[model samples]
Target chain A: MRAIFPAYLLALIIALAPTSVLATDDVEGAYRLGGGYALGDTGLRLGGYASTEIDVPRTAPWHFSLSDLSLFLTWDNGSRLHFFSELEAGDLLSAGEDESLGVQNVHFEFERCYLDTLVNNNLTVRVGKFLSPIGQWNIIHAAPLVWTTSRPVATENLFSTHATGLMLHGSVNVAQHLLEYSVYGDASETFEAHRSNNPFENAFGAHVRYYLTDSLQLGATYANFVLNDLQPIRYNLAGLDLAWSYQRYELSSEIVYRTTHHTTVENTWQGFIQGVAPISQQWFVIGRYEYFGQTQADAGQIGLLGLAYRPLPPVILKLEYRLGEHNEVLAPDGLSASFAILF
Target chain B: MRLRLVYPMLLILCLAGFPAWAAEPLAVVTAPDYPLSSLSLDDLKLIYLRKSQMDAEGKRWIPLNLPATDPLRRDFSRALFSLLPEEQEEYWNIQYFNGISPPKVMASEEAILRFVASTNGAIGYVRKQKVDPRVKVLLLITPFPPN
Candidate 1:
């Protein structure tokens, strides 16, 4: 019942879109079907993105699914105040032949809803739920924008992907290099339903980024969180990320470590290095290797090879093959393909 | 015989047109009211790419662009971003997801200059020959990237 509200809101907005569709004449630029329309002279804009995936594994049954359908609404009250909201329905449809027959895996929920205000030129304050600015992937994980059909297991499982509450962020220039930082805290369990994806109850985190050059960036993040369950377990995490690009060649990597104390202390780490190159105007080749380890379980590594073609910037066609050692049952070696579009 | 004749003809045409093509220069322009009269190439890149928002005075700086199909616009994008069209598109896709849009686009160089001249924070670029006294020249370079 909690999910019904977002579904209705999405339907209502989409239904009301056509009336202002004709008034969006002056917003002349590339027209993408998935791109939202500017609502006349108002500051409101609406857009959405969706993706479908097909996975074929060696031992398990092939799965075909509509993975994600999400809509975003942003309202800017001039330069001072901004509002952003996202509603997502994941695993909306799945082939019911075998594995998915009795799986109740569908979810409709609010992903992000935040209000941001510029306190000054160098500082901004945000209130509400948002993607944790821990690393690059967590913020920009939309399928159409990401290169691979599947996400790195390390990235998905290492940290809390979203948080609810207050965040303060700013950037300053120091010695010709831009330094950016964000500190956030989720003190109260106010929006429990909206923040179900957040694994922690009380959390505080900070991230800092350094832009050494136009082509190079380095960042570090730290967070302390408490599990919301009966016996609130305490945990501490640290992460480092790097991005570098030169012309058509690009490289990015991220590594994160976590430690938790309940009865005793345990430490775990995960990381991945990804490289991408454009072979032609429309084609890009990508490769990535990832490692995941824990004190209790055996360490594992996975490698992926993929290629993507973009007929248009808003549309992407991706195919990848995965090979792994250590956890084949959880993340099987398989061929995955997906077509995604952002409008 | 046909091949030999076409080769020399092509070479002659290339030799004759090279100097004329290379002579055109690009002029980066901002409003006269803007404090700084000149900018480094890196500064220009930051403004055009929407990575930087304010001028030295703390007032907002608005970047203007020409229509994508215009040759002058193509030249500016290729030279400044150092990216192919597809790569540029990919870059903008990411930007859009992050809630930023491309710079405002004008219809012609005259419109660009007129806008820049009237708007205090406006910035745009065009062929050097088309520049007028209305707008201040921030930077100038050959239309083609330096080889």
Candidate 2:
């Protein structure tokens, strides 16, 4: 049943394409690179992105896998109401020298499914499951959108990535600057839990971002949640992030601290700063450093250097190497490469 | 000797003014009944970037664009955002992942004018000469001096 969900979605989207095209008087050009196909004047759109990765670690067998295949649908009523949903199929296939080439256990999950009603210019009410607006990276973490193939621990480990409930979000212009904010809460279990991710039973969070300049912005986040465990531990978290870009060079950083009420080791914290510089029109040099301190584990520090090339706007190729003092599973020392596309 | 000096000065003036003369003027246009008469450069930038969706009156805006390769689009982007369409790819990618698309693109300036004139809240850019009475010119943009 899980494996067939993606197929069913794809079929549905394809089936509607011709009908939508025929209904509209004017149809935009066939297919755009990153821009999805507009399902005519119906206010519906169909699109998705996929990524493949190869990993070579010193302590483990080298492997190649289809990391992500995601399909998203969006509907806008040409007014205040909007709907969006994304379904992802992960780890679809794998191959290695020691392991035979074959289909692997695929994980299917709904990344986001939400309805947004624009109450006014200053506020929007969103209901359903949506990405937790904890930091810049997590909200735009699609494979083709981010600079790095591997995510920083701080972005994922300290908090739940998705929340199921309600969110109020909007942007306002204060003076000459732009201030954007989101306040969300989840009082129920996650809609469809992915095995790899930690979901909260009850959680609430707020994120605020202020644009200091066109190229730079600062962000703050706070959240409190209860873990879905037998013991039901309660945790509180706070995070800060910064992003700045000028011409072809960019710099971004994020830091998060989490505290639990029930544990003797009360706190865990992590952070990373990343920079990207253009080497050529289609190539970029990327570098990053990360630090993580877990409650009952040795502190870990990692440094990474990478290169990315984009032959086209919607496609990217990346290669990177990671080295760290604590070469554990969370921060393994290895070389990795990926090819990703947004269509 | 005087003629030579005059010739050089005239040449310099023409060279300095070449960009404004060579580039076509653009009209930021919308339906004739659109609530606002004009838009600030900041608001225009936000609309094109998909950051600002509603106007001061709380009406949703339907921002439109030209094809990526169109010279008019290149000029519009350069004049408004100081960035080329290619340079905006990364930004659009992030928006796409978040389910916010870039503005819908029309095939030609004529189509843009027609759409903007007929549809409520629709706004687009076109050659100044191409705008007709049916549409309202919200703002007039002069081409930037070439780098």
The DockQ figures for the candidates are 0.23, 0.53
Model 2 lDDT per residue over B12-105, tens place = 9998876455676899999898889999988899999988888877777888888778888888999998988888988898888878988877
Expressed as tens digits, the lDDT of each residue in A270-325 for candidate 2 is 99999999999899999999999875578889999999998887899999999997
Candidate 2 chain A has its poorest 10 consecutive residues by lDDT at A18-27
Docking class of 2: medium
**What's the CA error at residue A170 for candidate 2, in Å?**
1.2
For model 1, what is the error of residue B4's alpha carbon versus the real structure, in angstroms, after optimal superposition?
27
Docking class of 1: incorrect
- Find the candidate with the highest DockQ and give its number: 2
lDDT string for model 1 (A1-343, tens) is: 2222434444544444432111121225544454565554455667878999999886778988788988887664234555677888888887733765423678887777776766765777887777878777887889998899888766657567788778998777778777888999975465546556636677899998898986899999999988654556778889999989888688999998988866654688889999999999789999999898854467878899999997888889999998988757456788999999998
* TM-score per model (chain B): 0.82, 0.85
lDDT of 1: 0.76
